[model samples]
Target: MSTVTSEIPAVEATQFQHTPYYCEENVYLLCKTLCENGVADATGSDLFVVFISNEKKQVPLWHQKASTRADGIVLWDYHVICVQRKKESDAEPLVWDLDSTLPFPSPLASYVNETIQPSFQLFAEYQRYFRIVHAPLFFKHFASDRRHMKEPDGSWIAQPPPYQPIVSQDGILHNLSEYNAMSGADSLSTMDPDTVGAAVSQKLGVVVSHTQLEELFTKLP
Candidate 1:
């Protein structure tokens, strides 16, 4: 397959809105926004996938980490990213994870090569099974729910303030190291989160309440 160029000019990394703690979902929406507004030449509703890893075994896990509560409860079961094209002509889709500590819009090929050590995949059918709208609509209805996360210190704060870039300038190459495990693609196999996601969140000192879980899903299309 040939490489397809992006529809829109690739915005410099610094242009991205900075945030305190943008989680997996926030980036999914951001990428979808890029696609919808033709920012990256994206068209239609959007395309994204949700995936879950058992432990530190999943490389992406090492980057964004998962959503949790102050009491240390886990919320979301999977990490999701928008798989979109910068333009209609692009060959392979780009995987955009705004919260990723690795890089903002990782090429799907590179993403699969480095991340995607998976046993199961639940392609988030936002357009098919779920309805996806522009950010304004989402905010009008669910902004309050979407905002805020429990900090390690136990204070609740807003997430992904605005255009927070995925990876910081301080450790560009260092953050990329998370996917070092992907280089061993020949040895990789598919696997699911063997341990309960909540249990794992507890171990990480994060908590997701029942209400929070509902907000995570129902609020989105």
Candidate 2:
């Protein structure tokens, strides 16, 4: 929700650019301006702004921590790299210095891309019954203090419950938690999809057919 307004002039790239390239140039300029301001944490090592210069168009949004930097610097310090070049007449270069502007979208976007987006359809279908379907299963593999791990009824705390897998009609699986115990096992091989879907619906407090579940999964990101 934080808002940052900058009066600094846009760094113009001396070339005609379209929406995509112009956006990149703007981001580059924003980074340059932010690097000049030097608002990074003093205790942490200096941040360096980096991005691809077009050879690699699919530049990841995450600012990688330069492993070769000797100053113990972190990626958080230098967060922006306003894209340069490819400017067109009458097209305003856009800059997005996450350091000085809105919060960086990499972390959240990464989570969505690697986790949420892939499972979006599954989550949405399950959400109709259980709102918490999209939430990461609150798992407790081991407790530091086992003695203190007890429920309100004085019973031993049970292991965190895992959600049943919802398979799609096309056999495309999503949200497979590699860390989960049954992650290596294929749910469809042993258990029927209808049975699994029914259990999931029961746990979610809603009744849905396997086809409906598959449809829901198909509709999401």
Candidate 3:
């Protein structure tokens, strides 16, 4: 039952990033800002910000694809989110998913256990779910450090100031607009996600399918 105050400014950072791809870092930065702003009650590890990753075919909420579904949907590649529980206050833990692309801030279990039907009634081509992984780790984007195994072979390329991190409200909004833009005039209007999924899978070198990660999901119907 924990809720955000809505007082802090998205000018610093946010989870609702609109990058064409690679949202893990966006989520991480957003969590960092939330922690700074005391989203999970005065920060610290109690906030329980963990990284969730899994295989996905198309980008849910954004990707364009064919649909026999009431809302034929697609999935995204590795995604990240924050989880926290205020035992002393709220009765339930809240998922801080800013880029949720859905009604957002959905219950953690609902986001985790819900199937392609309820989830896809809005956007899913078939009844199939993929495996998702949970890790209690925060991934780093900028290579400020972690530069190891660097021989004298000029292994590290020099990145200038912009290499730091781009945290801007305007920029974020632009990216979000670009990412969520979907209309008959858009390119996805002509692309078939089912057929394009194979190319996506091959390029990503990951197995993306219209199948269920669990038999339970497959048998739900």
Q: What order do candidates take by lDDT, descending?
A: 1, 3, 2
Cα error of candidate 2 at position 116, Å: 7.7
Top-lDDT structure, candidate number: 1
Question: Against the true structure, what is every candidate's RMSD?
Answer: 15.3, 20.9, 14.5
lDDT, residue 214, model 1: 18
Between the candidate structures 1 and 2, which one is better when assessed by lDDT?
1
What does candidate 1's lDDT look like per residue over 93-192, in tens digits? 5566654544556665555444442322433321011111222222222222222355678666654345433332333322212211111221113212
Q: Can you give the lDDT of residue 139 in candidate 1? A: 21
Q: Estimate the TM-score for candidate 2.
A: 0.19
RMSD of 3: 14.5
**Candidate scoring better on TM-score of 2 and 3:** 3
Off by over 4 Å in 1: 5-9, 32-37, 40-46, 49-78, 85-90, 101-103, 118-154, 157-221
Clashes of each: 19, 14, 6
lDDT of 2 by residue, 175-197 (tens): 22221112112123323455434
lDDT for each residue of candidate 3 in 62-167, tens digit (9 for 90 to 100): 3123223454343543334554544454334445555544334544445544323334443332223222211122222121121221347846333222234433
Among all windows of 10 consecutive residues in model 1, the one with the lowest summed lDDT is 125-134
Error of 2 at 210 (Å): 28
Clashes of 3: 6
